[model samples]
Target chain A: MSQHARGQRPEAAPFTERTPRVVAARHLTRRQGRDKAGRFLVEGAQAVREALAWQGGQVHELFVTETAAERNPELLQEASNAGIRISEVTDKAADSLSETVTPQGLIAVCDAVPQPLDTALQGTPRLVAVLYGVSDPGNAGTVTRVADAAGADAVIFASDTVDPHNGKCVRASTGSLFHLPIARSRDAAEVFAACRTAGLRLVAADGYAKQDLVEASAKGELKQPTAWVFGSEAHGLPDDVVASLDTSLKVPLYGAAESLNLATAAAVCLYASARDQRS
Target chain B: MSQHARGQRPEAAPFTERTPRVVAARHLTRRQGRDKAGRFLVEGAQAVREALAWQGGQVHELFVTETAAERNPELLQEASNAGIRISEVTDKAADSLSETVTPQGLIAVCDAVPQPLDTALQGTPRLVAVLYGVSDPGNAGTVTRVADAAGADAVIFASDTVDPHNGKCVRASTGSLFHLPIARSRDAAEVFAACRTAGLRLVAADGYAKQDLVEASAKGELKQPTAWVFGSEAHGLPDDVVASLDTSLKVPLYGAAESLNLATAAAVCLYASARDQRS
Candidate 1:
């Protein structure tokens, strides 16, 4: 590649929305396209930065508008130095590649980063979050972020959960998607088998469970290696799934709310384990 | 009111989008309209049910699509028994009043239920969540829901935060809005002052704070009447706001995540206090 093409170029007409590569990147917006192409789009400066910085993730290309390039020269410089393709695109082109109402004008096309379940759970995992039937992109991603924050070993998207590589989920993860080990599986039993094989106890965060978070912690249950299973807030863990888990514990509700949002419950449960294990 | 209009009208021509009442209810989709009308829209079966159930709240009217009315006869019957205005609307009319892509076909016009700061914090309180400059409707509402679940005494939307009555906020709260006390304030100073006067310590949930939740709880600091203040995750508590609080504590990031989402952070802090105080 020419030196001029490798880094920030001098003022020139950027590629338009019609650019062939831009058109290809836009296809990553859909799940099937992402699956077939083995890539997904990451938007906004923070997420793009994480993509570039992630050792486990590969950011194949970077697209930035002139204004975004000006505002984030360091990011562009990093992308350029990493031998990634950096395409300077027009504002319209950036908009085409974005999913948010307010496009940040910085988008990165990265490899779909989730690994196979066995690979993600390979180590002696101390804490994990396994999601089942969580189809909301935002909720799935928020739970991933909380899992990362609580220092869980990995996050498993299992059994009909939204694809973590989906745009909204990636945005809601706030770059945590690139910071942790993520895996997906069509089989719930396999996910449980992998976690158990990794020496992690399975605990379902069920709202109706007689055992509460406080009691679980007090009983030294959270001190062990554990995988906290969660279902969508709209529908709690299926009875059969709960029956398969070693135990189920609810986050104690002190107020009148009948239930907690899925992500909130995950945060409370995962952090309780983090604290107990560390203490 | 005529008996025919009191409850679910059997197969009658449903109200169209242009109907006068539907037009007025549609206005509640915007913030200014809600402020001017002193009412807001609650959509979907879950929220509408809570609006009808709230003793402290007034459900001014109920709008239901024909299918929604059929699916939720008990909800409509309850509204009728309470003398609430129940208007069946066309599917198109229901869509016009909804913010979500898939309209739930149930809507309730309810009085804006936030009380004054002084009134909301009137009694002695063990836990509270105060949001300052939290502009995202989802985040604001999610915090409210978690606060309620943690048994927080109240939620205070202070200084540039999104109105809790926002349609998206109400939907995110998932009926928790009607379950607890909520207050709004233009003045952050007054919010802190009120909590202090009510014998509550002011704790800011600052990501950059020197003290973390586990350390705070270990020190027995969380076992007291406290109001945990939070700011937007994008731009954490302003420096001045953090300084004014009695103490600031961070939720420890056990993993590579730089910080927790606002609601996630609040959940960890509030639940810690709940456990500590209860223990």
Candidate 2:
């Protein structure tokens, strides 16, 4: 409501199944278009609402169904105030734009907002999560949301990690993808070098490690400025990567489970650091 | 090596795309057939291996492609020594039985082994993870694996929770579904009664809770016999359901993320109890 004095806004465009704009928005379904256009699409009410709340100006346009618009006119009105183009699209169009079997009927076309890894590492970071060789978009996205929830300064994806702009990744992140600065490094070595240059201690989340995560934090191991490297779910951290870190810590598995899934393990490690630093 | 003393097995039947037995196994793909036959299909090499190791004779049949059997003849040979039926299936048949987009070329039909809630609660349980209204099979399964990793004595799925025998759930459990005793309850009241009778304290993992999970465990709050309740991703524990619990705990959030995901939150809570009890 701060800058909404732009007064009365024009009505939304008529519902259309296909238009030049709709065609362009649909093109965001691919990585090539996303990179070329420097834009990505976020679907559903929660994500669109979060975009308006945080990155209002960056939201280029919003597409909604009649039902969605009627149910949440506030969302459209807010976007209109921020100069975001608003339009209505057919349910079929919404379904075509969605990855899920059932589409949520609201999509926000927004400018890509990923921060450069160098920029995110320039200042002292109290906590950071580096994803190395994480190929699953869902896992990568959840980790991004978790890093934000755990109060990490940023989430850095090594060159090999899945694109955070992937629709599935955006969906999995819920709304938190926009809440934090997502950074990217050329590789793990670059991540290590940057963390070292920024005075952040590097710690790897290794399931095979003897050091217990909670115990290590309790013993002041995670009290320093930290960067937690989470590896691929299948192979874990590379041997050289783990050896180069300050120390690798594991969440203790007391029963028959081989290890916690990647996202959960990341949550435990990041929260441990959050608690250790906050305490 | 230990089991081959049973001697040379009969020659395997010729690979086929469809047969009476294959049809029956395919029917097991649905819940009605599974309940009727008291069996479910476990696919992929990892799941089948774990099924053999944990459930042993319960694995009724081994269906594999020639490639799978040739690549891992020892697996089929072990099944043979165990007196389990070993049938080679055509690659197309294997594909037909698989639920995943890219089938891993192995499937095992196994007996259901869930224990009753009362039976699981008969003995003193050091830790438990309860799914009160969890609807997603994937989340339920991961929580089961997480609980097992945290050394919970058992995992209880209340009425209306997704079936633990569901194929996706089984896959997500990574065979921890067999590693721990899985119990089914009549409802929330039955779960509460059973937990009370067992002298187990109840804790619900709520994203909205004010009580911090890490702090609570650090204070010896989780040291006593505990049962942690996890709810659905869409609708968390019912208000009445949560009100009946001893307390609800949340993982502290230091940043802008609204909350931790269902699986990750469950993992953090269960692992907290695990660490506390061990200490």
Candidate 3:
């Protein structure tokens, strides 16, 4: 046995898996992970740390390269302190485990379903962001970060969007994913129904909408418990979702470019509502 | 000599040693050929199409692989129609010329500093996006696309920002860069001063700010000719700039996330102003 294997305490057993079956099970493609394991990979030191801090129980295992463990002894210490398992592997193993070219040498396998929507929506629950077919993981992650920063009640990803568990998305959120409530719904209508039951008004963001977001917010049209819906740049929101919304709001483009990126549109809409509720 | 060379028609130029040198000069990284010659590179069928559409007189030579010419006959015809010189290169040569992993196998060499900014910003420009020290080329490109969609008068890159002509940025913009007026300023203060003189309000975006964006814009605070200033996510707008701005606005953070991505923040700010102006 290696020195690490011999020195490994009982707490590390859950995390240190050398069997090919266990190792293979841990590696999941975005689609397979989302469907089968209901888990996603979160990489980078800061992101993994955030997950450890905020959602410790949800993290399945902690993977760290020997070099990374040497560099960040505190992380290992924290895992041990939290009663979380730790696995140390070679840099090559870590690289294969990572999504990005330059992995931060740390990664976490976490539950994909996240926490329950009700738990996330608890409290006053004044503001929320509803993502409709946001196809890019980075954009989706950014929306989560913005939602967390804006103190949104929750961020719901509707069906047909990119897998939120994609590595790029986790890094883009800058560790905000740990603190943010993200629920995945296969049906947009069902997600909307939940928001409606929660007493949230749906505000759809569309470039061609006649009502400007500022105007709509100022008129108290979006003042109630609200869910801001942002769509992909390629295809705006699905027709049915747009039709079912309480109001369609536009950001008001003055240039020749046709549309703003999906995440940017969401931030603008969410911030508008945040401003209205605060005042 | 080939038929193309023999014809001396506007359509063709036989492949020669000079052709590679001409096509290579357009990129900033290529120290040899045109980049060394202070030229710039334009790549891909779409970018090349836009270059043709713009009637960009700076185009020196065009490089096309046999496959590219076969696949995009219209692109070659368009170049030929414009009386531009065209050369057929080997697949290996085309691969070497491409910046992306999958080269479209088409590229153009054009004079650097295609068109001066003073000429582009001739009229009373109403909106502008000022990027300060945003180092990511992809972010810069996305910002440009958002600015264009917002109908901003121009997009300015402050010192230390990534080069606008980067291949990744150009691709990310989805050809919006061709339509947008992108200017570079070594001194941010000078750019801000110019905008101020031009009667544009300087709205600096920072995570920590006294006023919310909606309130600021609704109060006609950022309605007029305006320059939206965004900085890198790591270090936000410089203190000096923020202090000097007409107003500093923040997107309220309701969640625990510290900040939104730079491009997202800029889009939110720009769109807020767009909403106010439209209403």
TM-score of chain A of each: 0.95, 0.90, 0.88
- Give the residue spans of candidate 2 off by over 4 A: A1-18, A55-57, A92-96, B1-18, B55-57
Q: Which is the leading candidate under DockQ? A: 1
Candidate 3 residues lying further than 4 Å off, grouped into runs, are A1-25, A28-39, A55-57, A113-126, A207-220, A238-249, B1-39, B55-62, B65-80, B86-91, B111-123, B201-203, B210-215, B238-248, B277-279
Alpha-carbon RMSD, candidate 2: 3.9
Q: Model 1: runs farther than 4 Å from truth?
A: A1-20, B1-27, B90-96
The true-versus-predicted C-alpha distance at residue A85 of model 2, in Å, is: 1.6
- Model 3 C-alpha lDDT per residue in residues A1-279, reported as the tens digit of each score: 234432434333323345463476355645775568777667777777787777524777776766677666677777767776677665666666777878776777777745566665566678888878888888888888888877787888787877777777777888877776777776888888888878888888887788876667668876778888888878888777788998888875566565677777777778777777876
Residue pairs with colliding backbones in model 1 are none
Which candidate would rank higher by TM-score, 1 or 3? 1
Q: What TM-score would each prediction reach against the true structure?
A: 0.92, 0.92, 0.83
List, residue by residue over A17-106, the lDDT tens digit for candidate 2.
577778888888898888899888888888888888865238888887766677666777888778887777778878767777678888
10 residues in a row with least lDDT, candidate 1 chain B: B1-10
TM-score of chain A of 1: 0.95
lDDT of predicted model 3: 0.73
